[model samples]
Target: MICPRCAASLTGKQRSGRICAHCGKRFALDPAVHGKGMHDIRIRGIAERATDHGRLKITLTQLWYLSRTRNYAWAEQDPQGVPAGIRWLVALPVAVALLLCAVLTDGVLAFVAGAAGCVVLVVASAMRHRPGRPPRSQIIPSEETFRQLMTGAWSTAYGRLPKGVVDDARPVPRPRGASRSRASAPLSRPTAVILCTDRVAALFLTANDIPGRLGAVLLEAAGTEGTAGRSDIVTGALKELAEYRSALPVVVLHDADPLGVLLAPLIRAAQPDRVVVDAGLPVSAARGKQGVVRLARHNRFADAEQLRTVAGLPEADAKWLADGFWSPIAAVPPRLLESIVVRAVERALAAPPPGPRHAHTNGFLTWPQAPQTPHARDTGRPGAGTSKREGTSSA
Candidate 1:
């Protein structure tokens, strides 16, 4: 690891204390204290990738997922079940030793040892753990810890979070019975309405003031019904917006997960006459075929079969979703996602008013700017932004 302050390579000084030997600056996150993977270099790299070289801002939660070291898939049959390979690797040596003993010594003791080995194999195979997704479970450090580390530890050490890093996880005061209002003021004719499904993405939009900058009304698929409220407010706002400016196109942003991918369709279903564009993460980026971050969750949705009928997912896509695996839109690099949403809004505005169901799935090739532009995050290091989605991963 290198000292973030002086850019000097650490020479075993950080192990004993936070003070840098070369720069003498007291750093916040000592790898010794935070774990092997937690260090200044890693954090800097993550921020760079997430923020797209300071052109975009990344949420702390999205930073949390981007900082994760492992890639995993969910198995609904057993979320906590150990992998068969692990069991075999553990028992193989013992079984081989027991067989050798039984063969070398023709005694009852050897037979008993072999029997014990068999029992050990059975115990290992039968072992069960508390049900949990390998990805995004308690075993993985909580977002709170990551938040504190960045806010309390990292900030204290570095003065503040790196450029373009936003802490979206922090709680904010909400209006009481706010949802009842259901967008009291209808949009005043923005170019388009952005309907984002994931609450995090909605928060991201607010943290960056994306709606204001783009002249769009941003709405979440959830919330604004209670507490902050519900989708009814979203529905009401859409209806009002449609009525106010019937030709105003709606841009939909969502995760690549099965349920998330269908949110655009849901919006279109409710407002059949309007033009809705989906600029959210696509399944191709989350399917692991593209080598993006595809994480697991307990997605035992009763409507598992509806993925195909509702979202037009292929058999492979449907099967992947039915397995309780998904990729969050947060996984996409912050700037790239912004560009996608922006481009989607532009597309929505340009798209002819929906005379029929004008539906299409957008991918990386059609997502953002030309290749000459800078790259945003997801992968460990900053590289050229390719036609393929960059920094694509799920927690």
Candidate 2:
């Protein structure tokens, strides 16, 4: 047996109980009494809207005319379920004839001719209909059933992108612990700084012990080495920046190539002005080295002066250069900066400070919301007397 509503297969239990599992449409089958053998099938409620509503009677009339008009007299069963229709054939000819008559006749004559023909056509079309059609449930599916015919085709064409793809492309989720109303609260101290460098740069540093030295100075200044890559550094940096009592910098150490430049801007956009710093050896110097010259072929920040201060370059950088990686830049050799480090430590010992005075929090530490442009800092601009760089250098 088949479901009268959706046409899905049904078992003996479904026919006996009047409930179809596939579409949940119910039916009532009653055996005739008094020696009669006929069983009448009555439709009950449908879980889903029925597709066959009001179709049987009109379909039967359409099929009768369609068969007679097409000369299909040998059809053994009703043509309603066999996908035949007379209007399809007549409609094309009527359209062509109307256009031809309209063109041949002029003004009022053309209008009257087309109008009379249309009236006659309408009456003839109505007269061709057959009456006393079966219920829509009894009408079968065929090529002429336009809605059912297109159902599978439409589903096959456009059902690829699921519903939630548009929603998934929305911006990153808001920080888990950030409070917008209290965005400017005082942060904790000894803020961590993680540096992400390219694998090539990592190799050079590893071979010459450059990273270990750089890590030492950075460890003294900040505290940690952050990872590189276009991952969730935003969340990590935000946590570190928010917790640091003072402004700590998160540095990105990459080659001066196109990839490094692109990565810099991404980090900038991720946190805007909040200490996602880029500290790579200038491209000019990177390209000037003998063995390392090829690595700087596509220097990304070649146009921009990446570092303005000698201290910003990791201590390991100066050591590597002085060891002969960068001897071409005639202005100032890396060895000279190494001497500056030794002298600074000597001077600091000579005037040993009374004691370390650590303040738990500053009243203005978290005053302004995240600085708008790099110029206006949480402390102050780089140019003014109130600038945060008392003994520090700006890049």
Candidate 3:
């Protein structure tokens, strides 16, 4: 372990009771008790990278993913310690002695003992041949473990999280149409709406003020429990679309899961005239990569057939997601996720007004295509000379 305050390497002796011997300071986490990869220094480093060395702000949920050392699978073996050779060495003397006694004394009892010893040796060999546990790197620690480290251990030690790490940006939920935080301040008629399938991703963007920078309103995609209420933080989406900006471009960001892939189409159905850009994480990003951290769900919320037919996801990806595995967009480093959002927002901003071709359905990140015909302005598409709208949303 390394002392977070003094940057001094520590051994078990120096880290006794979770205190630094050289600096005489109390620290948050001990790798000895937690996993071998977890500690105060490591946490800080991961936070720094996620923030791009303090250029960006990150949420606790994002940090949780960055802290993982392994990507767990559904079926993993338990480690079987102690080799069969070692077990055989320990029992060989006893077994040979018993067999020798049986031959010398011609005793039935001694022969029975020798048979039992042979059976034990056979069982030990069989145990050795049994499948061994996977390596520790493949075993993912639960989110609860990281939560305790941040909430309990890190808080107790540092009095707060590391710099640039925002745990709960909005601790208390605000009623709809209320502006309580700086992140939720009203904008002047937002021309675009950024719908994040996961509330955590939306919260991250809000906490970091990413939407405000991009001149967009952040909304939690409907269908999840209690998420409808979150849309109230600003004005209702219907009012924003129908009254304020009827042709507002909607940018959808989501995890690489069944529900995520289906969310963009749902949003399009809700507002057919609006331009929709699918900025969600693709299944390919999380499915086959050994290094990607994919979390599993116990229940199957959506099916592969729907993903393939409706969302247009390929067969293999749909099958993987139907098995209830997902990788969160929030898991992408804060800087990268923010940058991608910026790019998607730019695409949204370039989108034209509603017309016959009002939406986009490209693969991973679909952008509204350029107006195909002349006099597109007559059909409601934006003209080349049209100026970009400066928009914002209320809290």
- Best-matching candidate per lDDT: 3
Ranking by TM-score: 1, 3, 2
lDDT of 1 by residue, 1-395 (tens): 77777887776744347788877787877666775467777778778867778766667777877676434343444345566677778787987788778777867988887787788778887786444323232213446777788899788877888777766756522323334233333346577788776777787776666676677888666633232344354455556555535567777787776556666676677766777777777675567444356666555342457888877777777777766567778766677777787778777777876654454432222554312322232344222211122223222
Off by over 4 Å in 3: 75-139, 169-188, 222-244, 353-363, 366-395
Q: How many clashing residue pairs are found in candidate 1?
A: 12
Q: Write the per-residue lDDT of candidate 2 for residues 1-395, one digit (tens) a residue.
A: 55555677667665555556777755333222111111112111110111123211112112111111011001011222212256646664775687679779899978976886677567545554332221111111222432221233222333421111111112323233435432222121223243434332222222222223333122211122223332334344344345443334444444433334334345444444333444443544443322222111111121222222222334444333222222111111122222322333233223322223312111001111211211111222222221111111110
Error of 2 at 362 (Å): 24
**Better lDDT candidate (2, 3):** 3
Clashing pairs in 3: 176-232, 186-394, 187-392, 187-393, 233-395
Weakest ten-residue segment in model 2 by summed lDDT: 67-76
> In lDDT terms, how accurate is model 1?
0.64
* TM-score for each model: 0.68, 0.21, 0.67
Give per-residue CA lDDT, model 3, range 1-395, as digits (tens): 67888989999999888899999999988878886568788778778877778766667877877776555434224445567677778768777776777666656787787787787667766664334332121223457788778888898988988877777644623323334453444355675788776777877777667777666888765443233443342234444445445567778788886767876676566677777777888787677644455665533456788888888888988877766566778776566677778988888778775566555543366322321211101112122222221111100
> Which rank order by lDDT, best down to worst?
3, 1, 2
